[model samples]
Target: MTLNTLKATEAATLLLDWYDRHHRDLPWRVSPPMAARGALADPYHVWLSEVMLQQTTVQAVKAYFDKFLTLWPTVENLAAAETEDVMRAWAGLGYYARARNLKKCAEAVAREHGGRFPETEEGLKALPGVGDYTAAAIAAIAFNRKSAVLDGNVERVISRLHAIETPLPAAKPEMRRLVSELTPSNRPGDFAQAMMDLGAKICTPKRPACALCPFGGSCRALTIADPETFPRKAGRKEKPLRLGAAFVAIDSSDAVYLRKRAASGLLGGMTEVPGTGWTARRDGDTSIDAQPFAAAWEACGTITHVFTHFELHLSVYRAKVAQAVACAEGWWEPIASLKRQALPTVMKKAIAQAIPHAFKPV
Candidate 1:
């Protein structure tokens, strides 16, 4: 049925009923009082998870989220953590900026907001790294507010339900408006989760199982016989390629050389092998410097990684030095202790390849 055809109460009831049986057994959803309650996913937990989940897959986030909670436990604890600690915890998980923001936001809450996460959407939005989607999610799920929650999953569900023909990037605004109108006041959290669950499980991006969807009878895209084509996407731009150089210098103690990235920009606060910016240049003219080296430095191998904005080609160099250099910007970390430290994906890949060969007993 059209959104205008159904009353708010009826729509909410149908969605909630479907949610009761269909919601995934995610660890974050259980209440604090339940015997199975894990870390009592409060607004902080929910907000953190939602932020990290953006542009990240659920499977990949599970271990990282659990590790974060184990290490920090609460927002206050997170605020107390050293920048490097937080970044390391966020390592392997792409989008280094989110990790930096996560720390900045936690500190803001602890210092300015008096250690309590703001309950209102507007208040939450004012904090660092909190955006409309994240604010809405926290308000609805944590505080049981009636705000509409629209992420990619919701977008797909709404697009198919209305048979929207406008390709995505252009269709987002109209979809959000329709979703807001359809969102009900009562049980809004359940309704939002229900829609997300429905879209993920039934109205999936590929070959949506229309037969199992609750709204299949009323779905406009289903009636048209082409649900996947409703919410089309504009052509994507080709990813640009960039190249970087990283140094893997080791001392007699078997400690690997690491440097702290700049406080802002890509992979901030994470530990990494000192390197030069990824640029488009020929080998002979390239100005990339592999941090000051004592012994001869030789190119070991190259690592290719993809980021949201561009592709990176990293050239790894190995060198052995007599003494650990004091650069004010870096430290020597033993190879065994590397896992305890946070390193960006690119850094991690570079280190993974260099350790065995670069640090081998000579």
Candidate 2:
């Protein structure tokens, strides 16, 4: 089916009808019935969910979203929170930069916009970390604006619906145009969410359930074959491997030494056990000579972590001391309370390698 032959209005109507029966009941969303009864979506919740959803899945975001809501009930409360506390709360959620930007955006909304999000996409884009897609999502979902919300799922659905064979990154513009055309001025919020739901539930990436899709008749890929292969991705380059060594120091009371990373660059502003610097070309010093201070350091296996652009292999070492030793920077944290600290996944893995149950809840 060609784009011209696929009646946009009819498709939207069918999708919305399907959504009324099948939309996912999420914690952050206002239902269609609620929305029709003059109940508007909360911009703060929408924005927070959008930010958390970036490079993260819906299932993974729910707990973090709930935790944030419990800790800081409002945007003003979030804005009033200390950056360290926010960072600590946001630990284990990769992409630390987003946490920082979330704080900045909340502060901006609280201070500049008077705790009210900008209703327009343009205004939302002006806030920190509010990119085009996030701005469009917020405007449509929160303010009921007629904005084209093109996320990865929506992109897949559009590419398959029209069978746009152009490889992605290059085909995004065409997909955006198609989305804009299909987006109805009325119920644009529901329309956007409907598209998202259709993509996620029926028009999935692998072995799509086309028989159950609302757009089965209108989808060009279904008319042809292999709807799963519509949005072809560009070739990915091999991620480079980097090496480092982490030092886990423990005193008699079962307290582990931990330190905060610098306020910039990768894994910034997160808690970690002291480690040698990681570089692209060379591995960090793993010899006993590299110990922070004189102690009975023993090798404690190794942990490998994959980042966005690279992979990291760290040689872990553990040292037990009778008394606390002074270091250039950092403090001793009780091993039982290690889970409460702002440790990233990689750091957690390193610690877990030394003390097996360090991260378990008390």
All candidates' TM-scores?
0.89, 0.96
lDDT (Cα atoms) of all candidates against the true structure: 0.78, 0.89
Candidate 2, position 208, lDDT: 89
Clashing pairs in 1: 88-342, 243-278
lDDT of 2 at 10: 81
Tens-digit lDDT string for candidate 2 (161-219): 88888999999999999999999987898899889888888888788888998776778
Candidate 2, position 253, lDDT: 93
lDDT winner = 2
User: Per-residue lDDT tens digits of candidate 1, residues 171-243?
Assistant: 8889878888878877677678788889889989999998888774678788766987767789887878787
TM-score of 1: 0.89
